[model samples]
Target chain A: MKFGIMVNEGPYTHQASDSAYNFVAAALEKGHEIYRIFFYHDGVNNGTRLTTPPQDDRNIVNRWSALAEKHEIDLVICVAAAQRRGIADADESKRNGKDADNIAPGFRISGLGQLLEASIQADRMVVFGD
Target chain B: MEEAGETKKIMYVNRKAPYGTIYALEALEVVLIGAAFEQDVYMMFLDDGVFQLKKEQDTKALGVKNFSPTYRALEMYDVEKIYVEKESMEVRGLTADDLIIPVEVKSNEEVTKMMTEMDVLLNF
Candidate 1:
């Protein structure tokens, strides 16, 4: 089955992000396809290429990026949420005449329309928040 | 071309006052994931959530880089149905022009219309 998952908590703030990642990873191991994964609010920090977690800990960003890359999944970052938190893609940075780009690989900076479209296309949309 | 058919719709209400919290981000994730599944998704900002739409959020000065910036990028995802309550904005001393992003600002009546139209409602 295909699934759409949203992770709103940052890895450092709560275990929700990690749990969502593990859930999706386990589902994939069981032969599930992730239709799309959305990072919002502080979760938007999940797409920052600038994150530097301790080496002893799991590199949540790397884990997420690798998972999406391995499965060729659609990793989406809410542009509004990300930008508010200082995560901007090259296109956005350039368009706004900003000096820096903060988008992480395997993730596309987008708007809520992508979320709307995902709901229409996927069978289930699960939200992991708080 | 209209659907002329019934489809499930979900509206996620984000009413938290940002800073010292993370609910706005969490609520937004639900909005996006739901949309990813191709479900009809809608979002509303009320109460302290009015701050979520405020512009000039440079949190870097406060050791953070203003989380409000991301809302501007929502258009590409097709999550265009963003809302803000007039009363909320007034209470916060905000005007549509003060927000960093362009959204369909409306009054309480308009907000209720959207809410009553939703098939499912989730608030955070």
Candidate 2:
């Protein structure tokens, strides 16, 4: 089945990101296709490349980026939510006159329409958040 | 990926109160954006979410946008299938007249049955 996943909370502060990662990994292992993974609300924080965890801890942002790279999944961070939380791509950074863009690799900034489109395209839509 | 112009039954489940957190407003934003796709959309206000439709909500003191009026504008966006859980409202001491817009007051069982018919359920 094609799945659309939504993450609505930030990493470390919540277990939502970890749970979603495990679910997606298991689903992919079972051969289910991922339509898209949309990051909204505080979940957009997962797309920032600036995160640095303890040496022993799991690096949440890199985990998502690596998974997307291996599976060729579209990892979309909601543009409105990302901007509000200061998670920007290089283009968005230039447009807003910011000095840097922190969006991690394998994630792209987009509109909420992508979420709606994913809902229509995917057979199932799963949301993980508080 | 699905082609354009194909419609699906989508439901937005709201369980949080407005102003206190961003869930209610976030759900509203998705509903408005989804309306443009011409899909069959439904909105359900249950638990503390029913407070979102309350009449005379003054957010000036809280310094937040009073979005209660936006409920009335939903009809213009062709999002008319709105439901309010009866038990939630009764327990909260609210009635249909207390809301800013018209909504079908449904029992939890009835709403559950409706939810099963939906293709997508987006909870906020």
Candidate 3:
């Protein structure tokens, strides 16, 4: 079965992104296809390349990038939400006249239409948030 | 991308107030975009979410954008299946007349039934 996922909270501050990653990894292990993982609200924070945690702690952003790279998952951050939270890609940064882009690899910024389309195309849509 | 003539019953469940957190406003953004897909979309307001539709909202004092006007424009976007929980309003001491738009005031049980009837359920 194909699964659509939405993560609605940022890392560290909430367990939502962590839980979503675990769920996606488990689903992949079970041989289920992940259609897309959409980042909305503070969840867009998970797609930034600027996060640097302690040496002992797990790197949440890099973990997602690796997972998406290995499985070729479509990691989408809602453009509106990302803009509001300052998570910008190269194109977004250029368009908005920002100094630099911060979007992590294996993730792309897009519109809410992507989320709606994922819900329609995927077998099930799962949301992880507060 | 969606196939031609393919549609899903998408429901946006709003259970938070408009301000304080960004869920309600962001949830509204999703609903507005979902309208373009030509799907069977429904917006259900319960708990403090029902407060999102109260009349005469003034966010000028709060220094935030007043988005209450968008609720009235929902019908223009062809999203008219609006519902408010009966118990949520009764306990909050609000009536249908107090809301800015017309909605189907359904009981909790009926709301649950309607939710089960949907193909996709999104909560905020």
Better of 1 and 2 by DockQ: 2
DockQ-best of 2 and 3: 3
| Residue A46, candidate 3: C-alpha displacement in angstroms | 0.5
Residue-wise lDDT of candidate 2 within A60-94, one digit each (tens)? Answer: 99999999999999999999888888999999999
| Lowest lDDT block of 10, candidate 3 chain A | A113-122
lDDT of 3 at A56: 100
| Interface C-alpha root-mean-square deviation of candidate 2 | 2.0
TM-score quality measure for candidate 2: 0.97
Off by over 4 Å in 3: B1-5
Over A1-130, each residue of candidate 1 has an lDDT whose tens digit, in order, gives 7888887777777887888898998989999888999777678888888889888988888888898889998999988777677888999999888999987789899876666655555667777776
Models ranked on TM-score: 3, 2, 1
* Top candidate (DockQ): 3
Residues B4-119 of candidate 1 have per-residue lDDT tens digits of 24467777788887666767665655554555454466778889988888777767656754667678767777777777888889888989898877767789999999988875
